[model samples]
Target: MSTPMGRNVIALEWLQFGLGRLVAAAAEEGLTIHLLTGERSEYAHELAELDSPHLVVHDVNTHDVAKVITTIRAIGDVAGLLNTTDTWSLVSLEVRAQLGLAGPDPACIRLVRNKALLRRRLYEHGLSRADGSPLADTDDAADVAARVGLPLIVKDSAGTGSEHVWLARTPDELTAALDEARRVALRGHLIAEPYFLGPLYSVETLTWEGRTRVLGVSSRILSAPPVFREEALAFPVALPPAVAADAEQWIEQVLKCVEYTEGFAHTEFILTDDGFEVVEINPRLGGGLVGEEISQTLDINLYATFLDLVLRRRPALMDAPLTPSRGAAHARLYAPRTGIFVGCQGQELLSGHPGGPVLRPALPAGTAVRTIAHQDGCVAVLFATGATSELALQNVLSAAGEIHVRMEGDDRG
Candidate 1:
């Protein structure tokens, strides 16, 4: 393998909502982005449509490590390897390690990718209160229930978007949840843990060379269980000074425990009566326009900061004001029922709304809408800004209420 030093950063996948910002930032920094994605990914066409001189899309099987490495070598002069999505973090890390680039440690990526291992590490470090066990089959559900107790959550050890996650209120429910989880287990193992009831908050942090900085704390709106589908997010949410400090302290400890050296980390936790209990840690930026919301609230461009981190440069904006100049929120719109989508109504009202909420549909018209199960069921996302949190949230709600998806089927309630 020949190493060619080029002004190229290889992104393992490009389907993330924030890829455009990354590409734009890279272009501004006089860098080129070589996006490696599957041939069938919409990103291939999306990148082509951009016609950006700094952006190049390569059709390759990302799952094949050897192929990806070969492609990277063939491109040569690779300055960095990175990914902004959970599904491709490991792949990105592997490529970075193979190429001897700066990134999170491979062992750390392994620990965070496997929920069971993450729980174990946290438990050992006294960072977590809950106990969890890994289940490989339905037969293990009874033992897991006995260990973790009822009202527990059974989920794939490495699942995303709440996929194959189920809440079990009883032993029978536990078994059923295990069965459901087994069907979608990406790693053929399920993790069962006690479910804490409380509001969820995600702490977005950027770590570089082992130094961690908390970017923002965002409150999460989630769909009702047996599935923890995230519905919306409001950023720059106020937290008691002590609570915020403690959450950041915990996040820093987690990064240290996992030996995460660099990159953005999105850590989710429940604000319970006792204290903050960790839910999970995603080694990437928060999804669902979180970076955009943060940018609106704090005047920080996280996508640009991510590029600076990859280049091993200190992000100048890190010292910028952390206080929110304006409140920002993102609300997800889901299809009311399964049907063929015709179009969205009340879009004109949103265009003229006072709060300047931006409405973006996930799927275009003439798309099929299936049962609302996970985040994939979301039809659109409404982004709004206001002088206060209540106003921002209200703006999103008002716009979302007016915009309705016109579907063809009448069977769904």
Candidate 2:
């Protein structure tokens, strides 16, 4: 078990927002990036501004899948197995079939990480119009609102960043979201569906074998829901060249309904008024500063397609030559309740705003903002740039409305 010489890889733990662009796209090509991590301080601002020697920071325990497959089987002869992270993509699909490497098909990443069997398998292949009801401890809420009706949506079926998800709408808000989902604290289980409204978008593909390419369209400024947070994001959302080629042929039939061939997905849908529906398919990539706002507004690096899908090959983002210079966007800084975060204030006037809005910081000062109803109260973020995407979302919402986030809730962390 000792073969490492040059291109060694294995990043089973990542995505506290693209660890410094995955260590500068694993230092060009002569890769390295070990990082097995079980919380290297959830990447302290990408390991405090990485100076990368092709990264390598392993602590392990990564939620103990047999102690992360007995520590990447003593790291040897590596060159495949990287996960942008949906809570570790089934631990890199059980460490790539217990170390044969090359991924996909751990039963298609457990049917795309089981959103109650991907909404009843895309409502039995009709590509979903709704059908996900799993919440049984003797089911209630009028049997999931007589099969997911009145503005439903009680998520978690293997949730992530939009944390637990809830959004009821009535029946006393689905019995107060099932009494706050029987004392909320779940990473996956409760289900229910049907909340297809509008305005939300993600699709930033990259596939190889099953061939996908869209790599654009972001626009998702949520927050005014039964609670899902997610406040700002903007990117190539212009759509209308025949509606961006029919949203890239409906996300290539929703990544061929989850066969999702090679690397990178980030799906999320909901164009509504009768069209693109899907709203949960993050096999990874669109979480905060979305892959660094699409590699700084599409100049494109996209972690060099996760170093050619952990080095199996063929992924220069599927025939490059794409372009789109400026226009990026990001925005978060949730603090209107639950507190102790103590920081941020006009961020030194964000480099005299415009597009220099930087900020970042997600939870650090005394950290203890328990629940602003998910995404752990997103303590900070700003990121801007413009010339499109509605002027980079109005320059990150005018530099996140001139900063100001200093929590306290009677202090105590």
> How much lDDT does each candidate structure score?
0.78, 0.79
Best by lDDT: 2
Each model's Cα RMSD? 3.1, 21.1
Estimate candidate 1's alpha-carbon lDDT, on a 0 to 1 scale.
0.78
Winner by TM-score: 1
Q: TM-score for model 1?
A: 0.91
Cα deviation at 169, candidate 2, in Å, is 13
Total backbone collisions, model 1 = 3
The window of 10 residues in a row where model 2 has the poorest summed lDDT is: 1-10
Error of 1 at 279 (Å): 0.5
lDDT of 1 by residue, 1-413 (tens): 23334589888885436667777888888889888888433443244346678888888999898999999999987777778787887878777878888766778877888998898888888888877888755356668877888788877888887777789998888777766666653743677878988999999887777888898788888887776887878877778798788888878888898898877788899989988778888888888878888777877566787667667677666666677888888888888778786767888887778679887666666778776788777777888988876678778877888887777764367
